[model samples]
Target: MSKLKVAVIGCGSIAKHRHLPEYAQNKQVEIVAVCDIVEERVNEFATKYDAIAYTSYEELLANQDIDIVSVCTPNYLHASISVAALKAGKHVLCEKPMATSKEEAEEMIREAEAAGKKLMIAHNQRFVPAHQKARELIEKGELGKLYSFRSAFGHGGPERWSVDGKDSWFFRKEEAFIGAMGDLGVHKTDLLRYILGEEFVEVGAFVETSSKKNADVDDSAVCVLKTENGIIGTLAASWSYVAKEDNSTIIYGEKATLRLLDDPINSLVIQYIDGAVVKYELGGIQTNDIGGQSSSQVIDKFVHAIIQNEESPVSGSEGLKSLQVVLSALESNETKRIVTI
Candidate 1:
């Protein structure tokens, strides 16, 4: 079979670091085109990847040879671009916080179904090695009777990560739709859901813009979440950790407690109530720090799904479910009440 043709929209930091590199590494894929609002950036990526360059996504989607589209644009454009790509008979791999609202997310899923194309959300956290192991252990009853947990994803800020640096859309509320919660929090929410095998049913939050200077969006947010299985936990998303990054989750259970990405050396550690300790140096989680780029395994799964005509590991509906938690947190912050999912 001929290699699947792929086009990437938004040649921003995500495309630069994650989608582009991974897609290029996939032998089943051919990078056929790249699109961005910035002519220079698109051309640069096209030259680097040996693909066609276009400034308009509509124009790029018109290329019938392109079988896949990676929507790595700002959070606001995710729904529209994915819907258009699906309508154009192309599979879509969209970045996190798939849509700004419930209606938009539903529309994307509906269009993907109607088009008979795959729509996968790029929630890379689920693909982390330690996270996968944790899920396996939880499923095997290693952590019996979970009591509570805490998961946090934080760093200095997105400015250093975005291609545009300080002028990036990450700090702009109009373009981003949200700040820390949508950018960082949504990933943890998805990871927790995948690890625990449950849906978040209720949430109360204190989302605020505490640290980033001159930013209209929330820079820090802490939410209390309750899962359908009666598991209660704290989820924090922040861009204000100026000193260092913290991408860790601690799960307290009746038998043992699982500490993930907590220690610098051991990515996962399990301590039993009966004085037993287990450690696994399964590598660290992905971070914004230089040389922290690890294979997310998202693009590989997406390519395989399309080739085998199978459902995406992280489908649009799943993305919507994760997105609902963040949306509820935002609502909870506004209403100061526990919002029900």
Candidate 2:
């Protein structure tokens, strides 16, 4: 069987760190083209991948040989690029916070449906081994009835990971939509839904651009969420964790507490009320942190979905639902009241 022809729409840090390498590793994919607004970046990635380069996504999508497109552009451009790719008869793997608004995300999904092509969101946290294991344990009722939880994702800000350093699109509200919430909080929202198998129906938040100087977007945000089944919890996304990346979650239950990616050594720690503790040495969540070492399974799953003609693990609708959570959080912050999904 001929390998699927893949084209990446943005040659940014995420495309470099996760999408490009993983797709390169996939024997079933042939990276045929790369696109970026910057000529230098597009040319560089094209040379590295032995693919064609384009400064415009429209030009790249015009290639009839392309079978799949990864929309790795800014948060605001996600819907437009994915919609264009889907209309051009190519499957799409879009990065998370699928779009700036629910309506736009729905439009992307509608376009993918109309084109009869697969659309997957790159919510890589759900693909982490420790998170997968946590989902399994929860589904098996190992933690008993869930009561409350706290999930947070933070780093030293986009200056470190973004290709353009501090000048990246991440800090601009016009391009990023909603700062830390879109970048980090949505990952937690999606993970919580996957782990608990429930939707966040309501949220109250205190989103702000507290720390980072002269930034239009948020440096820190803390949201309190209530699930449909009465599960209450806190979700925090910050770009001010200069000390270290803190991608951690703690789930409390009747019998035990599950700590995910909390400790430096143990990726998962489960402590019981009866003085028993369980620890797993799973690798850290892929936070793009220097010390964090883990590869994503997102590319593999996306390829399999295309091959099998099945919906992706993080389908467009599912991704939109997660995006709605972030939107609701933003609304909650503005209104200073709980917003219902």
TM-score of each: 0.99, 0.98
* lDDT tens per residue, model 1, 1-341: 99999999999988998899999999999999999999999999999999999999999999999999999999999999999999999999999999999999999999999999999999998988999999999999999988899999999999889988888899998899999999999999999999999899999999999888868999999999999989999999999998999999999999999999999999999999999999999988778875676588999999999999999989999999999999999999999999999
Candidate 2 lDDT over 214-290, as tens digits, reads: 58988899999999999999999999999988899999999899999999889889999898999999877776764
Task: Tell me the lDDT of model 2 at 238.
Answer: 96
Query: Can you tell me which runs of candidate 2 are displaced by over 4 Å?
Result: 290-294
Against the true structure, candidate 2 reaches a TM-score of: 0.98
Over 4 Å off, model 1: none
Worst 10 residues of 2 by lDDT: 286-295
What Cα-based lDDT does every candidate model obtain?
0.94, 0.91
Per model, how many backbone clashes are there? 0, 0
